[model samples]
Target: MASSMLNGAEGLKLTGMRSPHGLGSMNSTLHGKPLSKMGLTPFNLRKDAKFVAPKCSLSSSRPASQPRFIQHKKEAFWFYRFLSIVYDHVINPGHWTEDMRDEALKPADLYSPRLKVVDVGGGTGFTTLGIVKHVDPKNVTIIDQSPHQLAKARQKEPLKECTIMEGDAEDLPFPTDSFDRYISAGSIEYWPEPQRGIREAYRVLRQGGVACVIGPVYPTFWLSRFFADMWMLFPKEEEYIEWFKNAGFKDVQLKRIGPKWYRGVRRHGLIMGCSVTGVKRQPGDSPLQLGPKAEDVERPVNPFSFLLRFVLGSIAATYFVLVPIYMWIKDQITPKGMPI
Candidate 1:
């Protein structure tokens, strides 16, 4: 019966002994091991039998020169070192507000208190505070590459039970399929390789689990675009969807969110613009393979270059900080139901 299912299937030709039950049954095996043992569930087999990978519409190629001043690991590390002092107080109020954090995490589907969750690039416990609202504090783990940022997260009383550690987003330290939900907020912009970090998100999630990434979107206005380019990664909406599909996630979805003052005016772009969620259908590492790491952490850095990038990056970052305040002032004068 298992053989009958593949009778007319194209490209896939089953060879070797077969069980009486269909491939959907647990009796099926490929090379002496049960298909179930190999992470090949009935859903995967049925999908693979006729699945043709879709061609990505967007180009994966990057620019020759580094566009953003703070996109690299080293630059971001030092950038956060000082920013961590006022991140929760200043940055959160203007950009990553409590309201925005709650809305962004909703698609992550943190429904169960028993769910094991890993908040990747979770800085200062701002987003983790939202995760703890749905899941138990002990069940959540917050990982970031910035030690200074993690130190601030440790100070939060509500997140005391949550595990806080310093780790890379592009290369997570956790084992594959170790988490029920993978979440990252306001962090992808700093990643030199956004796709690699997204792949890790897929790799760490259990089968049937969800991975939600919330980050900034590119601005349309000319002035905002210039500042956004110099600041950090501001990926377009299509780029986010393409990255998730390439990572072998099924049921991919994206939800747009921003501050109330914005009034859906996305021409300027918000710091935390969209929430993208995808579910892992089958387990193990992501299918998309890449050559090497974009940024080498062990490599020596030049003192002069480091200081230059840090200064310019901080200057660009200040523009984003002021954008929300400017918008808020406009929102106040504008009528309640009108766009600011």
Candidate 2:
């Protein structure tokens, strides 16, 4: 029964693609309502909803020059346990505001209301909310490794119909050619293997589909670079484009983004600096080859070391939190049009 239902959904998707008006005008209704309202499932997992191991070996090598405390999956899982509580309120206002979110998502081309979209590492559904503004909530899926963050997303009234699941970004469970659009925002810095995650993004997207990844660019200022290195992976802009190109994406483009108060100053590097978009021209897995899983999740962690790293990483993170406030104050006092 599940298989038949799945087949039916695929038929709808294919039919929607042929329509002139896109998926929105397709006859995907059941009893005068969308199929999702009647529990018509969309996800077609590779291993019966279990983690599907990547085809290529995941390299454990660190992409950034220095090691970051929260780059590991286990550490990040714990970090968001506390941050999720005040994430939308505290982080959103300073770093990822509604305006910035909207502007960054523009290149992803969320044009069809019935387009199937996946928000990988969708923590707290902040970016997913931006997606739902253009597409139907039922057509969206939010996946993140952090249960605490997913809990916040589940509580959002606007996201009631969206499918929310706990999943890894580096090893997505979905089959290839699964989604029309893929988006990940402010989540790449936490990835231990960012290239693997970006590869997964390319794998899941259907031919002609778009993948938009929004993440922090490495800081140039000496002080900001110190804290950024300690806190998490702040990749240089060129790395983002290279990752997409290696994954077999075509026409890859990146748009620079930052807080309004920052006044175009990239010396310190905004928490969310660029939005990179790429089109999937093929119909299978990413072309980028990798080797062996980086960090072993099953490896036992020492209690003392974990405590020390977590504490120091939290302190480094505090510096970034205060940076926006400091810049905002400067922007207010530095005259109307001048940069802060």
Candidate 3:
């Protein structure tokens, strides 16, 4: 039989294979037999036997510069970092225009100069500028995480009076019940957790404070996939309602700010946008009803929208295609350079 020994000096177990004789030495044979006969495999235990570890490339172990998967806020932070330069001049003008901002702020009733307002994720001060138009700029606070975007906002002459701070929407750093009005626009699409951000809005708003959240509507499935590069979340109207109610908001109402069509079969603003407004009720007020109500959808009994689409389509085709063809035909028939 072979015996196993514990090499206390080296802190290693010397496992000896069973043989007809006794235990084998590390390099020598057991009794009169060789290591092979003793069924013992030789291990190179020499002090100078350098261990050659498997080659590990740093490239394989290192993390990537950009994230593998897109995170909403992180992607938006980087997106706006560069886009901030062209945001107000190029993007905001076409989409979230001054008219749209006015429409969003209509419900807030910012007429009172004493009303304190906070615009969460207010990048480039597009919405902030609108708020200050009604309320005093000194009473307004605009908070956003991207310094690049906020830097442009800070340079705005009107926004200079408003306080600008860097902060997150989901976890606002402000005190509870800090503002009388909360408004967020063109920013909710980038919220990683829309519900959490809304809750923060509620937390920072005082009793009877109005909170208005404006964002893009859920687009057609194909459109959603195409906009995947933008890393935006288009919430349906019901989602906005649910988010507000879940956050303990009262008097919650969903309003379709843009147009609708096809007897409400297709919403004109489905891809364009929508706004949800809710008021923080006083303690005694009743709880808000949870889902969207039937009246939320305004559907016309007649197929009037189809006619509207047809008329617009006809005008577009006539001006763009038919007009050019008619002009060419008229020139050919009239003869070259002849007024007659």
lDDT of 1 by residue, 3-36 (tens): 1111122232222212221112222453474433
Instruction: Give the lowest summed-lDDT range of ten residues in model 2.
Output: 12-21
Clashes of each: 0, 2, 0
Candidate 2, position 44, lDDT: 28
What local lDDT score does residue 115 receive in model 2, on the 0 to 100 scale? 97
lDDT (tens digit, per residue) of candidate 2 on 86-188: 9998888888988789868877889989999999999999999999999999999999999999999999899999999999998999999999999999889
- Model 3 Cα lDDT, one tens digit per residue, 1-340: 1111111112222222111111112344424545333222233334433222222221121121121122234445666677787877655543455755775566566768899999998988988988988899999999997999999999999998899999888778988788889999877766656776787778888887878898765433332223332334556544676687777775554433432111111111222255567777653322323233222113442346434433443332222222223333554677544521
TM-score of 2: 0.81
Stretch of 10 with least lDDT, candidate 1: 1-10
The C-alpha RMSD in Å for every predicted model, in order, reads 12.8, 14.3, 31.1
- The Cα RMSD in angstroms, rounded to one decimal, for candidate 2 relative to the true structure is 14.3
Ranking by lDDT: 2, 1, 3
> CA lDDT of 240 in candidate 3?
74
TM-score of 3: 0.59
